[model samples]
Target: MNIEANNTVNPEVKVGGQTLRWERQTIEKLLLANVREQRAARRWRMFKTLLWMALLAALVWALVAQPTLPKTPHSTGIGAGHTAMVSIKGVIADDGESSAEYILPALRSALEDSDSKALILLINSPGGSPVQAGLINDEIRRLRQKHDKPIYAVVEETCASAAYYIASAADQIYVDKASIVGSIGVLMDGFGFVDTLDKLGVERRLMTAGANKGFLDPFSPQTEEQRQFAQVMLDQIHQQFISVVKQGRGERLKETPEMFSGLFWTGEQSLQLGLADAYGSVDSVARDVVKAENLVDYSTEENIAERLAKRFGAAVGAGAVNALRSLPPLR
Candidate 1:
């Protein structure tokens, strides 16, 4: 007696007119096939799940650990606590890495950071353009007044001229005893090769509609009038720099009238001149005063790709400039 699982007829056997049918066995075979399919499906699902988990872990590690390309080796201060240090490098030019665009953002981050108790400006510039230096100084004032966070300027190997202008805005300026400081002045040095060109039978043929169109061309000799004019421009810039420093340092600056004559000073002489607030390195100030535990450098880390792009762009720009200069005079 055989009965199918779906419709059992409680009979010993179900037979057709010409053949007998094994219904129970057929039903068992169908059930076994379904069980095998389900088992294979479960194994496949487990394999897919394991693969997904491994891929996810690899992705997580890549995201959380943003790696940096190796750069010039230098020791940075590492404390036990969590405070960020914003470091400044190179000349403070309107263009290039030292521009206000790069500097002000770092300063703003440091000032607005809730985790940082105070901010440090690590300076190692020989100075650059007056405009760039002034822009930084203004931003520093605004940040200080807004955030009320103590800002310290730590001068490294050297901090002169425009660098000093920016540093003066710090709540207190710290310098290594051996650091080069001062140079509170402005200068635009250049060479005129017109006499040498005449000796070599070369001509500097220049024509301009404006009287002072080529005011300070390096290939042309300057008349006394032009020299006086250049000096006046330089003097004006120097005066502006002096005023900014005085405003930032207040009575802390004890400089003689000759300080703005474009002279450089050692870090030791700087303290007495009121150019710097103290003579100490970053570690001394951070550990002794701010009490920061860990120091994190917020400066942008340059990668190989970024540097290569910069070089390529610079080369293209230089080529364009040379091409334009080589063009014949417009008739």
Candidate 2:
């Protein structure tokens, strides 16, 4: 009897004068597949790492980048005589765009430019922090005296309260006929939630080391003494604001009983009241008054990077607060 070979059990098979190892071929294919998989995984990991690094770099740049100044024709050496402009827009707070920190630097740069015949303060704001306004006001006067460059305030839509406080420092104030002007006053505003809490039967638990530590806490009740004290402080600040305006306006101010009563008026009425010098815009003032047709903006505006960084900071702070709130309270 002839015996046939079992192809299934055979590790190697001979065909066409060549020996082929079936098990070796299977093993090789598996190894290749594993290698390819590992390579693909490594590539993905590298891509993720690079993406993370790029994001980190961008965040770092945003945090460290300086604010960009407005590009003007006078960026290089002063070529021709021009009127320098610094915009005081939005709320005039310590952390706002029209803050003294930002405004003062722009003012100095504009005044220091030899080609600039005059500086114009383009103001449009409802008003904000008194302290910030006061600082800007003081610097404007000082810069004018030092540089011997006349500074004029050109009001647009509105210039009231703290906005007017800084504008008062200018040599002359020009306003549009329909512009809102004045509001020479001080105010401290807040809401009282004590009554609401009582109606809701919600108790407020507050602890403070000092008696006046929680003076203006909205959740708590305010004492008569505290109210009186706050009023006194506001009165003092109001007086200071009034004095500054008087000094800045000098003989031009036509003070009335309601002028400093936190009242606003039209720009036309402002001129009649001597709160403004004349009717003019930035262009008209630069062309006719300053005698320099060429205009150069020296405003120190917040750049994209600075704004991004600020927003990022706020987001991180809010996230942290939320995380803290979500945590379990300690015994």
Residue 199 lDDT (model 1): 95
| Candidate 1 C-alpha lDDT tens digits along 35-121 | 999999999999999996876565556444543322222223342254557777887776556678777777776656566677788
The parts of candidate 2 lying over 4 Å away from their true place are 1-75, 315-331
lDDT of 2: 0.89
lDDT of 2 by residue, 21-74 (tens): 778899999999999999999999999999968866876786466545533333
Residue 36 lDDT in candidate 2: 100
lDDT of 1 at 16: 38
Evaluated against the true structure, the overall lDDT of model 1 is 0.77
What is the lDDT of every predicted structure here?
A: 0.77, 0.89
Top candidate on TM-score is 2
Model 1 pairs whose backbones collide: 1-12, 79-293, 80-293, 81-293, 81-294
Which sections of candidate 1 miss by over 4 Å? 1-81, 314-331
Clashes of each: 5, 0
lDDT: worst 10-residue window of model 2: 67-76
TM-score of each: 0.70, 0.79
